[model samples]
Target: MRVAALWFPDWPVQAAKLECDDELQEPLVIAAQHRVVVCSQAARAAGIRRGMKVRHAQAAAPELTVIDANPDRDGRMFASLAGSLDDVAASVEVLRPGLVVADLKAAGAFHGGEDVALEMLVDAAARRGIDTLAGAADEIATAVIAARSGQVVPPGESAAYLARQPLAVLTAETALAADADTVKTLGQLGITTLGELAAIPPAAMTTRFGVHGAHIHRIAAAAPDRRVAPELPVADLAVAITPEDPIERVDAAAFAARALAASLHERLKEAGRNCVRLKVVAELETGQRVERVWRTREALTESATADRVRWQLDGWLTSGGAGAITSLILEPLELMAPDAVGELWADRASTDDARRVVERVQSQLGIDAVLQPRLIGGRGVAERIQLVPFGEAAPPVEEKTWPGAIPAPLPARLGGGIDHPASRVTLIDATGKPVIVTAEALLAGEPYALAWGDKKYLLTGWAGPWPVDEGWWASDANRHRVARLQAVGREGGPQGDVTGWLLVWSRRSWRVEAVY
Candidate 1:
């Protein structure tokens, strides 16, 4: 197999700074969650380096501007670049948040061999204002190093080619540094070449470096048994977009969605598929994401996909708009090959027809307006069934049943109707132990004080303090942490009704564990 490894050096730091006020071409570095993320070539020239302490980095280059790395944004943008490559390659596999490897056996041969394919990739990436280094060899590992080193190894000579490279290239360490004065490159090792490295006793290497040392030996030797699978075809298409201008207005975002949908349509067409799962990514100027996915039918036209994008964008904009919009992307998670027109009878629903229904409903009602039940763990009604995109795999449900917990329903809607008519309740003395709430005080009487908001109110009527229990066997039961109470309103309502349900809100509901 002709394997190629494409490397995007410093992609995260570069992608993160794209939206910053600064051009980011000079000495720059990114600190992610308060640790060194990456530094530019200029920063390296200034003695500032990747993984350096933030304070130390500043000390090295006083003018260096630092931006916190946004991993999510960088990941989505990298995915977009991968999706764009689908137009030229048979498959595009994402490697982490930055790198992607494209199989060239088919695409390369069709494009006039490997050199042409590499050049094509360079051109494609250049159009997006990206600089990438690519290299090809018989073994995937050899290609990875060549791409990083900006060298291409000829086929059938990977072992000889890799022998001259440094051992640091194969080591998995993210921060490349030497431990001792005797530091030597892979080429300088006793096993002077890859062929020699392969001849080293595997048991000895394993004892010395554990599994990692064994892996290094295998890569150096060009292990014949190792297999690099072709890029896995995307199970579902997903997309995200960032606009050239900040979207301050809601309607303006709608216009951006139209463009994104058109782009997605082109991708789907090239993939020979139609989609039911549509994901919309809205990049906020704050650098946070307002993303949601919905179940829909196969989208036959670019316009249909655009309509769904418009719906999601409008929903996000109207729901507080999240300050400003930067970009939008549409992805189809559930997809099928588009059907031939007039292939089926009118009474039957073809794949295309089903896809159309999904798109229409998604376009009409907002994407969030329609939901599919996904099982989740929790004793609360709202915590049980999760809303997810239709046709997508439901998240695995776990056994979180507490011995005496209230049985909750799956997929509960919030703030709709009460079991009974309007009622009222009140607090008396509102202090500690066996807290008192009197009926008469609520039935046209006044309470001395209220606790939560520290406000006083007149009581009218009363309801039972419904008790809820959870995690009976755990330590939570002893702490009074497993219980919840629901109370009616003391005042503040049209006819004095409960506005919110108060619960101890168990921590288990927040951490969901899924079985693979």
Candidate 2:
């Protein structure tokens, strides 16, 4: 069967770029254990290369920014690309972060032909700002070689094409990297070339290298026998719980979710499956229902699953959801075999400590105090994270366009936010003048400082004075207009205390909205 190999050259660097809100200008490289793993194009031009010692790379390009290479982050980011490929290909096998092999005939036929299919897939990658290189051939190995060397071998000419290539060519694709070791072994056996290795009888090769030897023999002959595997369809596996009495207490709801999650885990394990995506459903006594979906790239262990369920319940009950839950359900939207997922392990001590704290907090304070905030985007700091009782639905913001919605890298704050009712702060412009907004959504001036209690802070860097005209066309005198600013500062001057703050202009004056 014809197959195609697609390569993403610098996936780790690309993932970092996507996660960063600020545009990275300096040359950057991702290094693992003092060795360069991947480098930006600019870094390459500055003499940085993969596998180079990090110290040498840095010394060569002093301004190069180094980022740690994280396997988890790479895998998580690649899932989106894999999902996109799944839509257009009949079968796709992920080799690693940067390489995937797909059934070319099927994807090609679906898009009307091979070239058009590659174009469509390339366009899909471009939509996500991913650069990709692709090539096709009759066999998987040939396809991989073609992709790396920019060749499209003829259907029946894979053997001739591969025979002419050096053994080191195998190192270019992740799928063949492991087998490349066998190539090295073959070198020891006085067979350093593909044609030389192919002349060895299959039985002798197998005798020398076991199953892998037999596999490499076929590769040397340019005859690949492999099929891409498709992703498993999501299964709807659900388990529900109904308490005899309405579950009013946070502890009671948390207990119910924990038990249900454990049961769901056991059931799936018995069936040799695991869940990565789940939906929580809660039905309240007042007839209100709440639902939310949670997903992770890694497989959810029993405790992790329960924690999510408990968090959902906590938000529901604490948000003045007004009624106790009558019933709750845990359902898996996506399922896969356990081995297929990578389970991220956390330290047991820290995990248990965190669990104890959440439990103790819910017991001592009232449920409202043990709330969880749902992260979202909005024009105002107050609208960015909606605090609901730990297991409840967050307060819904209107779906209309938030013209002045702040970009990410949101301000960070603790305990009831910046307007915490127990603290106060003032927003001032660069001239040490109070910042304000007029009725027309116009800012009085750019914010440059903050005055909180007795500590004075001077702004260093900032963005906005983003304007919002909400309810501006109202017939009555209820029209409202506001301007928002995100300013960062330090306490004594530009060097004392560094932090980020969100400031808002409304009701004719400005106030500190949140601290980050």
Candidate 3:
């Protein structure tokens, strides 16, 4: 039941250093909520220490480079090392950003002996440019302290070793057992050390702090159950299909992929696993094999998984390859527990199956064929409303303030009806003169009527001459001096009802492209 713990001092700072491409010469510190968590070696030398206020640390080291602490980044970066450590420790459990606990006896036995195993673990971590310290004891709690303090305790000596240590050694265990205030309470009670706290009857402690206090008592006792628990096993989900006939076209194969994806996703849901990577393998009728991998930052829903498969098949078939998919296989490469993030980082809840139908349609039609309008920074309604491929991340929409950009209540279509059929239209003033917007963002006349083809509608209300002047400095630039307006009007067709429309003034004329 020996426990082994690996501790990476200042792991957040270490992870940040690894992530940043530039050489960081300045004293650096990772902070969260104005509290210092980890600081660089130079920052340490400059008297910037952990537990110090961020302001105090900055004051200590004026040249300090303060980095916001991100636990997700630390965990994500460490996940890349899981495969490498699998051989070293068969059952490794990640405790936090800097801490890992494993079965000491098993890990040591795998690499000859305990000392050799610790040495191997250190060497392996060093090779990856991660500084790690190893410590082993009969109990997990003792092992954590040993690793943190660079000490190793003999078998059955964990309790004695922990007795001299302060209660602060539990800093990295997360909020599982006790809160930080509990430590202060213990010290205030004259239980200044682990030995003093351990001496208290477990029953009395439970009466005071409930289960958490009892947990602390057990850890202090260094019992056998203190052994590290292995991480939950990920479910391996794979789906394969063989159609009655060899599917030659991407359109036909997509249906099969969609069915298989749905089945795989349902199985994954039942098993409580979410997939992030899909490996699509197709066996062509000509006996040639095609395989492609697609990965997403977020876990893929059933439809997204199908899209990746379809996209892969589309590329493979459209390349003039002499193949149709006789057999298709879908494999999930990575699976994560839905509750692992708890929606703090990502939504843990499963999406509705109805959304899957819409996404599937977008997949079948091709990314370009289906587009979603995004409000990017531009002057006119048409210019601001750019159509992007459905399901793709919207391009930088509000990256910078395009000062006079039209505000929301956005239009669904643009002039000549971009997303719909085009029609001839005329916009006129109350005096029957055509409405126009001057270069100085002044309207020539108030709009009173709108004429489209054979039907005409009366303008109900109007607002704004919001102006935007863009690209005026460059000679070759397509300079635009545009004004925007919002209006409400009823259509000439039956069941006519007043609806909002986002209108724009461009090329000395006014036009509306949408009914909001």
Candidate 4:
């Protein structure tokens, strides 16, 4: 899959300059979450850098003009530029507001050669008063990295070209999907270049960092890239809306655009698919029609699709070439299946259906209303299972070898809480004496019976007292010295089924920790 990438440097700053003409000459910085996300050339010359605190950046450059980052505005402004690229290549994929990529093989053949094809793309962007740096390589990651340096890597030379790049390239906006923390961790481990990262065995990378590591390793090694999958849209999936009132103002157009976007996305989700290319069509009151096609490297979410629609409308209404819009239509020009991989025997369709239901419920209630279980590094069963928001990504588990963690076949159910009445229990010996865990991590006596709430049961079998001594460096309130044992019990009062219980002895008290 030979690919080409076109990058617009300082895009956020340029987008800001387009919004306000006065800031073009000033040392401008775009701030998000009180930090400088991107700084203009002038700001950089004044010693202002990206990721610096906004206050400190302003202090360093007293003449700095700070503009709050607006991603919608950036996408809105870049819509026209992205549209221009369509004239050069038929399959343009926008990675973000500033970065666009496309398959170069077809375009190269039509334009005489790959170099000519790349130059045509740069010329297309330059015609719109935008500076573009273009690069082509055998893979998408290498192409993006090459674009940053304005270098067109020769065929079959992607691996060697990427080897000379710094590890920081992994965290570029258009490069591999690696996070900053992962790159930083690799650098601290003495792997400061792509060559060093690629030299590691793929198995070792996978063992250390799981799937993410394997993906990065493959890209660095210049393995065969996955074929670009593009789907043709079914005409029946298109959605349209005719507002009761003709929309004239940008705010009103934005409202109508959002409604159309949501309706289109719901239809796409119902079909168990995602959109790759979106077509926005507007009908003016004077019977004039205008439309544009927006493409994405990944699936387009509801908000992203809405931003494109809203931006298109804003451009038309604000450009003074069109009147109030009488009707609007959104069409999915291309579609793709969900990217998540499922088990071989798993019902992927049913799983996707259930996820959509959960997302719908979360949208109605709140993001925190639906929680999913994630396993983390911890000694106790309850501490290991962390509940996070349903759609959020699970945090990386750093500690791979937990010395005192409970062994597998983990308990099926955890007790309510430490102080809950249901979690309290009593373990007694044949002499009616309570069984305790000694400081030496030994049991006082063999448990003969168990008293849980209002039921009594005879102990049939039991396992060892797995000792856990954690947080010893902290205060007394934070320290934990407990021993857990798995026991099987039969009901004494009624001839009922045998039940497995996970009991813990801590603070001189017996409590039920989990149920198997």
Compare the candidates by TM-score and give the number of the best one. 4
- Model 1 C-alpha lDDT per residue in residues 1-516, reported as the tens digit of each score: 776666777886656554342356567788864557787777889998667898888888888888777644564455444544655666444434455556667668789888888778766665333457887777666777677866778878888887777555654322111121112433456544455666778897778554445767777777652233332356555556666678766467657767667566656656767765455667777888755444332243555555545545554554453567777766555566654554344653345455545554454444554577765755545455678865454545666655543333222234321221221222453332223323331222232322333333333433333334434667854643323334334444345433333322233211111100
The residue-by-residue lDDT of candidate 3 on 1-516, one tens digit each, is: 877777887778777776663355568888877888888777888988789998888788788899998754565455433324555776565544466666768977778898887777766666334567788888766787788777889987888887887776654455123445566677788876678788899899889875557877777767566345432345567889999988887678678868887788777767767775556678888887755444453467666676656655655665464477789988776676653222332332234222343454443444466677786666556666677876676645457665665667566655564333343356789789987777667778888877766767788888887876677886645785656678776777334767676766655555565557
Residue pairs clashing in model 3 are none
RMSD per candidate (Å) reads 18.5, 20.6, 12.9, 11.3
lDDT string for model 2 (366-468, tens) is 3466677776656676766766766454555556666657776766664354445434568777677876666665567776777777888887887777777
- lDDT tens digits, residue span 15-89, model 4: 777766443557889998789999887799999998999999989988888888887788777765666666778
Model 2 local distance difference test score: 0.70
Query: Candidate 1 versus the native: TM-score?
Result: 0.43
Each prediction's whole-model lDDT (CA): 0.55, 0.70, 0.67, 0.79
Candidate 4 TM-score, true structure as reference: 0.60
Q: Rank the candidates by TM-score, best first.
A: 4, 3, 2, 1
lDDT over C-alpha atoms for residue 25 of model 1: 57
Clash count, candidate 1: 16
In model 2, the runs with Cα more than 4 Å from the true position are 127-129, 177-181, 230-516
